[model samples]
Target chain A: MAPQSPSSARAALFDVDGTLVDSNYLHVRAWQRAFREIGHDVDAWRVHRAIGLDSSLLLESLLGDDADSLGDRAKDLHMTYYLGARDSMRPLAGARELVRELHGRGVQVVLATSASEEELDVLREVLSVDSCIAHTTSAADVDRAKPDPGVIRAAMDRSSTSGETAVMVGDAVWDAEAASRAGVTFVGLLSGGISRAELEAAGAEAVFEDAQDLLDRLDSSPLARLLSL
Target chain B: MAPQSPSSARAALFDVDGTLVDSNYLHVRAWQRAFREIGHDVDAWRVHRAIGLDSSLLLESLLGDDADSLGDRAKDLHMTYYLGARDSMRPLAGARELVRELHGRGVQVVLATSASEEELDVLREVLSVDSCIAHTTSAADVDRAKPDPGVIRAAMDRSSTSGETAVMVGDAVWDAEAASRAGVTFVGLLSGGISRAELEAAGAEAVFEDAQDLLDRLDSSPLARLLSL
Candidate 1:
C-alpha cells in the first residue's frame, strides 16, 4: 500500500457485542446457565455487568476460587449455550449505517473486540458491513482482553492510527476503561443496559442511546470532533 | 382475621421479577423475541428498561403506533417465550431469608407485582417462602401497573398497612416512582441491572446490592426505620 497522509489516517474502533449487536443479554444468560451447570449459581445482572471481559476473566470474576476447578467446563458450557442462541442475534439499529458513514467520511473503521475468531465471524456476518471495515482485532490478537487496553492498542496498531486520531465506541464500562487506558477518546452507547451515569463515570466523553442515536447526532458527537482533528 | 395492633401492621411490598428473582434479563430476551416475531425488532436494553411496566403499556411504549396493531400478539408471544424459560428462573441471594426475616420481625411481607396470577405462582414457588408472605397482589387486583401507584396502594391495603408504615423494595424505576406516588419509602436493588444513579434519581430513598445486601443491613435500612415508626 502507498504511504497514507496523517489526515487520512484517522480511524474509529468499535466494540461489537453490546455496542453494535444486541447480544449482551444473551451472553449474560449463557454465562448464568454455565455457572449453574458447574454448580455455581451466578446472577444474570452480575454476568451482564461482566459481559465485556474475556470469557476466562468473566468466569474467574463471577466464580472466584471455584473458577480454577470449574472454569474450563463452564466456559465450554457457555460457548454451547451462546452458540445455540446465535440465531437470535441481530445488528443494532443503524449499526451498519454508522460504520459505513464513518468509512465514507474517510475514517478507517476497525472492529476492536475480544470475541474469539469464530464468534467474530458470526458477528461480522450479522453486521454485514465488512466492506467498510478497514481492520479488525479479536481475542487472537491480544494477551489480555478489555479493561486491560491491550486489545485497543492492537486495533489502533492494525489500523495504522494513533489514539489521538481515533475514537472508540462501546457499551460497557470495561470498554471505557480500556479506551481511556489506551489514551483514546471513548464514546458510550446505552444499548448494553449500562446506564449513562455508569458509562460517564467510567470515562466516556460522550454517551448515546445506541448506534442509531450516535449516527443521528454524529455531527456534534466526539466522532465528528475526531474527524475534524 | 382479628384486628391487628398498629405496630404489627407494618408491611414491605416487594417487586418479584428482578428484585427477588433473577428473571429480568429473561424478560428482556422474551420481549425482544416477542417484538421480533411481530416484526418490530426492539432492542433488548430498551425492553429491559421497560420491564416493570404492564405488558400492554410496555408494548405501547416500545411499538408506538405499531403497538395498536400488534399489542395482543406480542403480549402472547412474550408470555410464551417467558414461560418457556421459567425453569431457568432462580431466586436472588437471600430472597427467601429476607422475607422470612421480615416476617420474623413482625413486618407483613406482601408481594406487589404486576405479574399475572399464573406467573406469580411460578415466582412464588421459586422464592419458596410463601408462608412468610402475609399477602400478595397481582395484575388481577388492579387496573394499573407500577408507576401508577395503584398496585402499591392495593398491596398496602391488603396487608392493612398505611403508607407511613410500609416500604417498597424493587429493582426498576417504575417501582421507585410507584412507591413515591403512594407515599411509601422505596428501596432500590441493583440486581435488575439498573444503575444506582438511575434508581436514586427515580426517588429510591435507599439502595442495596440485592435482597441479601438489604438483609445484611436491615438494622440500618428504611425497613428498620419503618418498624421503629
Candidate 2:
C-alpha cells in the first residue's frame, strides 16, 4: 500500500476538567472554599466562568489585583483545598467507556487538560482507565493553555493525526477557540458551566449535554467517525 | 483624563521556560530520562524541540504509537522524575531582575508557560520573584501550548492589555510562533535551545542573549517605545 497521507490517521482529544469528567462543579467548590478562606467573596458562577482557563489566569481574573497580592500563598491554598476534594472526583458519565471504546478502535484518545500533575493523578485515580487513555496533558507540558490550539495540535501531532482529521471535545469556549485555531472540528459538551450558546458562539460544530449524550448521539455526528471504535 | 487608546495600554508578555528561565536543558534531561526508563531511545535534542508543547503532545511526539501502550504510568514517571530535579532549576541570567523591573515600571510582566502548578512552583521558588509576574500560564490554562497564542492572549486579557501594545519574549520557535498568532511582537532570546535564525523564522522581531540583553538595549529598540514604561 502507498504510504498513508497525513490526514489518514485521526485523533480525538478531550478536555478532562469538565467534558470528560464531572470535576467542574468540584473545582468551583474548591475555588469557593479557597477564596472564602482567603477572606475574598467569589461567587461559584463567576468561578465557573473561569474554569477551563489556566489556574493562574483564572485566579488573576477572579481575584483581580488581589491575585498579585495573594501570590503563591493563594495558589498553594487553592491546590491544597482542591487536593482535599480529589477523592470525590469522577469521570463524567460514559466518559471512560467512550475513551476506551475509541482507543480499542485505534482512534487515539487523549486527555488534553489544564490540570497539573497532582490533579492529573487524581483524575487518573478517579477515572480508573489510565491504560485506556492514549495520552494525558498537563500544564507542565505546554506554554499556553486552552483557547490556544497547541495542546490539540500536540495531540494531533502525537497521533500523526492531521488537523482536518482530528476533533477536540470539551466544555468551554476555550476548547472551541483552541479547536478553531488548530483548524479542527470542535465538539462541545455542556457538563461544565458554559452554555450551549457560548459553546456555539465559540465555534463548536455540535453541542451535547455531556459525554453520555455525545455517546448516545455518536452515530448521528462527525464525532462518531473520528472517535469510532 | 479620558480613556487611553487600546495601544496606549498594551503590555509585553514573556515566556518563562526558555525565554526568561534557563530550564529547557533540565526539561530535556527529565523527558529523556523519562523516555529512557519507558524503553524508548529518544534523543534529548529531539525532545528539546517539543519542550514548550503540552505533555500529551510531547509524549506523542517522543513515544509515538507506544504512547497509547505506555499510558499514564509513563506520564507519572515523567512528572515524578521532572519534579525530582526541580530543586536545581534556576532563572536565566538577569531573568528575575528584568521581569521585576518591567513589573515595577508597570509593563505588566506575564509568564506564558506550559508548566503545571507543581512545576511552576519549583520555577517560582527558584526565581523568587513570583509577586512581580502579572500572569503565569501553564498547560492547564490553555487547550494548547505555544506556537499557539492562547496563554499570551489570556495574559493580555487579565492585564487589560492588547496585542498592539504587547510583545512576547522567549527563546524558542514555539514562543515566536505563538506571538505571531496573537498579533504581538516577538523578542527572541539566545539562552534557550533555539537559534536566532530559527526564532526569526518562527516570527521573532529581534534577538538578544537573554533578558539582560533586552533590558540593556531597551531604550533604542522599538520594544522600548512599544512597552512605553
Candidate 3:
C-alpha cells in the first residue's frame, strides 16, 4: 500500500546512473566493450534495459546463464574495463546545483544506483558535493538492484526517511518501476537516455529534462511543495 | 557475481504459495470472485500467473494502466474473501514432514514468500511448524514481489545465508525467475499446478512432486544432503 503523505516529504531519492550523471551511455559502451573482449556479441541497447540490474544478473540477462562458461575470468574482465572507463564520468547539467538546492531546503538527498561500489567511488569524486549527500546505496548493499526498490528502502533507512516522506527521481524504466513498486512518487528525468513514454509507462507521475529542469520547475512539481522551495 | 559459495551448500530456500501448499488455485478463485465483484471479467489462468505478485501489481498486470479504475477495489474485495477462506488452508502432502525432517537433520530451512503478513499468519497456524522456520519474507518488505529476488534476498539475509548457500524451491515460473535472478539454485515443486517444462523454462535446475516426494527421493536429489532427514 502507498504510504500516506504528510503534506511535506523529508527526502528525494535520486538514481545515480543516468539521472544524476550522463553515464548510461558510457555503461552501455563499457559493457559492450567488455562483452566483445570476452567473445560475446551483445547488443548495447539490450544491455541498457538491464543496466540498473545487479552485476551477475545484468551479465546473465545479457549473456544468458551459459556465460558461466567463461566463469570468474569474464567477471574480472568486465569490472576492470568498466572501472577503467570511469575517467569519463560527468554529472548531468544542474545535478550538482539542484542537489545543493535541495540540501539548502533541508531535504535529505540520496544516491541510489545499481552501480557497484567501484563505480560509485568514481561518481562521488565527479559529483564532488560530499556534504550534500545524506546517504547512498549501491549494488553491494542490495541483492536485487533497481526495479526492486531494495536500494531505495536501504537509502531511506539510512536517511531515516519514511517511504511516505520520500520521492524518487530517475531516467529509466527500472527507476520508475522501483518507485512505483515502493509506493513513492516517481519523477522521470530524460537525461538518462530513456524516453519519457518508457518512464511514464513504468509509473512516473512527472517528467523533466534532468536535474536542472526539475530545479527550474520545482515550484510546479511535487518537489516545490515538498521542500517548500 | 554469483554469491561466493563454500564448495557445497546445506541450506535451501522454499517458496510458499504454490510449491509447499496448493493455494494457487485458491488464489485464482478468490481473484475471480473479487474481479467479477468489481465489474471486470478477467480470465482465471491469467490471474494465476499473477499469484506471486503483490495484489495491486497483480491487478495492474492483468488490467493494465487503467486498472485502478476497478483493480484496487477488486483487490480489497478479493482479499476480503480470501482472508475468510484461510480456514481451508492445508499443507501439501510432504510439506510438514519435510520441514520436520530438515529440522532433525540440522539443515537450515527458510520461507521465501510473497504472502501478506495476514496470509503468513494463517499459513503458520495451518502448517503448525513454528520452531523450524529460520526466516520468512512478506510483500511488505519488498518492491518487485516476485519474478524479482528481493524476497529471496530478505529471506537469505534473515537466515544469515548467501545466494550460493541457498536453493529456492517453488511451484511457479515467477519463483524460478526470482531465484534465477538471484543466482540461486532452483528446485521446482509440482504441487502448485504448474508443469515441469514451465518451471525449467523459468530456470529450475530440478523438479519434485512435493516435499514428501523430495524426501522420499532425497538421495537422488542434489539437495538431499542439506535435508534434515
After superposition, the stretches of candidate 1 with alpha carbons farther than 4 Å from their true spots are A1-7, B1-7
**Candidate 2 lDDT over residue span A1-229, tens digit each:** 1114455576788888877666665566567667767777554345666788766678789888888877467678878877886644557777878887667766777787867888888888888887777677787778878777778877776667776667889988888998899898899987664667678888999998777778888778667766442
Q: Can you write out model 3's per-residue Cα lDDT over B1-229, one digit (the tens) per residue? A: 1113444335667887766665665676678678767766554335655677666668788778658687768878878888876754567778888877776666667888878898888887878887887677887888768887898888877766676566788887888888888888888877665556677878888888778788898767757635422
lDDT of 2: 0.73
Question: In order, what is each prediction's RMSD in angstroms?
Answer: 1.8, 19.8, 19.5
Top TM-score prediction, candidate number: 1
Query: Which number leads on lDDT?
Result: 1
**Model 1: clashing residue pairs?**
none
- Tens digit of per-residue lDDT, candidate 1, span B1-229: 2225755678889999999999998899888888888899988999999999877788889999998889999888888999899899999988989988888777888999988988999999999998889899998988989889999999999988877888999999999999999999999999998989999999998999999999999999989876565
- Report backbone clashes per prediction: 0, 22, 3
Candidate 1 chain B worst ten-residue window by lDDT: B1-10
- Proportion of true contacts reproduced by candidate 3: 0.00
| lDDT (C-alpha) at residue B13 in model 2 | 79
- CA shift at A120, candidate 1, in angstroms? 0.3
Docking class of 3: incorrect
Specify the CAPRI tier of model 2: incorrect
Please give, for residues A142-198, the per-residue lDDT of candidate 3 as tens digits: 888877878888877776676567889888888888887777888998776555666
Pick by DockQ: 1 or 3, better one: 1
Write candidate 1's Cα lDDT for A1-229 as tens digits.
Answer: 2125755688889999999999998898888888888889888888999999876688788999988898999988888898888899999988999998888778889999989898899999989988899999998998889899999999989878887788999999999999999999999999988999999999999999999999999999999975665
What's the best-to-worst order under DockQ?
1, 2, 3
